[model samples]
Target: MNYDIFNGDADGIIALLQLRLANPINGELVTGVKRDIQLLEQVQVRPEDRLTVLDISMEKNSAALINALDVGADVFYADHHRCGDITQHQNLQAHIDLDANTCTALIIDQLLEGQFHLWAITAAYGDNLIAKADELATKVNLTKVQAEQLKELGTLINYNGYGSNISDLHFHPADLYRALLNYPNPFDVIIDTNSPFNLLQTAYQQDMDNALAIETKHTSACLSVFELPNTAWARRISGVYGNFLANQQTDSAHAVLTDNNDGTYTVSLRAPLDNKQGAGDVCSQFETGGGRAAAAGINALAKSDLPNFIKSVESHYLV
Candidate 1:
């Protein structure tokens, strides 16, 4: 059996989409809400099975990966997130780049010689590699209007992946990936009246409108913090909303805290756009936290530690 295990975000879904579009495959799709990164554990691999994993941190899935390898499952892994020392195994092919500017879809783009360059660019935009995506779009001579369309499509697809669970999302990541498979070109997704793009666009706007209406919980010269109620819209918009806040104030770090309803909070932190460092390191201090430097998150932070989290982020960036 062949299993495709990927993060349910725009980067992961688009990465697999480009791969399968270039070399079509029939495989079991394994994915969940964007935060659910330990997907390999769900697949009971046989010695003859093959696994394609993308856009998830190797550090978080290391044990499952070793189990698959131990069982003789050949695995191909690609990601840009923090990865500890990787295992050297004959059954594993890993493509990981920790450069803040690159994402897994772009890695696949290089491997495929840009056969699906447009989709790769969209993934870059979705992954918040805005300047990089713009550079690629310009090199390809995509018009400004076309570039904006791709950006919106990428942003909406990315926003759909932010829920705490599949139930919180408008479309399950697997369903979103399958919905997008028909459009090998990102432009086709934009042009199709009935595509997921239309639904996502509408949904994104609704959520963003609601999020924008909420006032900040804390604000200072170097940092700003906001708290969101425990609603599906809040869960769906938190990450993208952090991106929005970062863009609005490029020099200040921002935090979006969503109530998790268990006396804990789900935290999305973004370092200053001008200095994208320390976010992953700061989040990693918590048990359920980890991510890239520019963008990081904590799955469930105790409500009592909210003050400490704020102080940690402030101290890291304020100096």
Candidate 2:
């Protein structure tokens, strides 16, 4: 059987979307919330099983990957996150670029030779590589209005991936991917009145409004932090809200912490836009935390460690 395991976020979803569109596959889809990156372990790989994994950190799933390869399963992996030590196996085909400016979809774009360039651009936007996406859009001769449309669509799709779990999300990422597969061109989804974009847009605005009303928990020259309540809206809006905060102040790092209601907080950390390095490093200092350098997250952080988390962010960016 073919297994398509990917992060539920825009970069992961769109990366697989572009690949499947280029090479059709009827694979079992495995995904969860954006923070759920240890996806390879869920699949029971057998000999000859084909797996396409994207946008998830290989370090966290190394053992499972080794198991899959040992079992003679073929694995194609692509990601931009921290990959510890990659296992060299004849059964594995890995495309990993750790550059802060690139995402998995963009990597696939290069592989596909930009057949779905527009969707790749949208994924870049959704991943909050705004300046890079804009540069690509201009190179393609997209008008300002057209670029904005893609950005909005990308942002909304990204917004849908935030939740603490699939229950908090407006659409399960698998369903969203299937719905999007019908439109090879992203613009068609934007133009379609009945598309997921419309539903996500409305939901995004409402949740964002609620987030905007909350005051910052802490702010300084190097960092700013916002603590959100333990509610569906708060969980749903945390990651994108961190991106919004980062865009608002490019020189300062931003952290959006949502109460997980279990004496822990779900943390989304963004490095300063001017210096897109060290986010993953800082988050990795804690348990249940890992991601790309420009953007990283902690799935559950204890309240006691909150101060240390802030101190870590400040110390990294203060320099």
Candidate 3:
């Protein structure tokens, strides 16, 4: 069997989309909510199997990945997240870039020599690498309106990935990937009257509106924190909302904590745009937390640790 495992976010989906568009493949799609990064363990690998892993951290899936390689599976992995230590195996082909300004889709774009450059730029925007995406868009000579259109499409797609579970999302990641395969050019999705772009755009605006109305729980020169209610809307908006807050103040870090309703909270942390570092380091200090430098998250943080979480963010960015 062939397994196509990827994070459900825009970067993962678009990265895989570029590869498959270049070289068609029929593989079992394995993906879940954006926070579900330990995806490799879910698959039962065999010697004859082939696997393509994208976006999710190699560190989180190291054991499963090693097992797959040991069993003689051919694995192709690509990501921009924090990979602890890469294993050396003939069956494993890994492409990892930890640069804060780059994403998995952009890495794949280099591999494909820009066959799907526009889609890669969209993924960069969705991943919140705004300045990088803008640079790439300009290099491609995209008009201002065209650039904005792609940015909105990317943001909406990314927003759809931030739910607590598939139930909370407007479209399951696999279904979303399949839908996107129909359009080689992202602009096509935007222009199509009936596309996921339109559906997600409407949903994103509503959720973001609700988030914007909430007052900050804590704010300072170095960091700002917001607490969101335990609701589907909050879960759907938390990650993208963090990005929105980070963009608003390029020098201040932002944290969006959504009540998990189980004596815990789901935390989304973004480093200052001007200094895109330390977010993953700060979040990693707590249990159930890990991610890239610019953006990281904790799946379930104890409510009592909220103060320490804020302190961690403050200390990291303050330096």
**Whole-model Cα lDDT of every candidate shown, in order:** 0.93, 0.95, 0.94
User: Which sections of candidate 2 miss by over 4 Å?
Assistant: none
lDDT of prediction 3: 0.94
In order of appearance, the predictions have TM-scores of 0.98, 0.99, 0.99
Residue by residue across 83-105, what tens digits does model 1's lDDT show? 89897899999999988889999
Instruction: Quote the lDDT for 205 in model 2.
Output: 97
Instruction: Report the CA-based lDDT of candidate 2 relative to the real structure.
Output: 0.95
Query: Of models 1 and 3, which has the larger TM-score?
Result: 3
- Candidate 1 has what TM-score? 0.98
Better by lDDT, candidate 3 or 1 = 3
For each predicted model, how many residue pairs clash, with residues at least 3 apart or on different chains?
0, 0, 0
Clashes of 1: 0
Among all windows of 10 consecutive residues in model 2, the one with the lowest summed lDDT is 157-166
* Per-residue lDDT of model 2, residues 91-194, tens digit only: 89999999999999999999999999999999999999999999999999999999999999899988999988789999999999999999999999999999
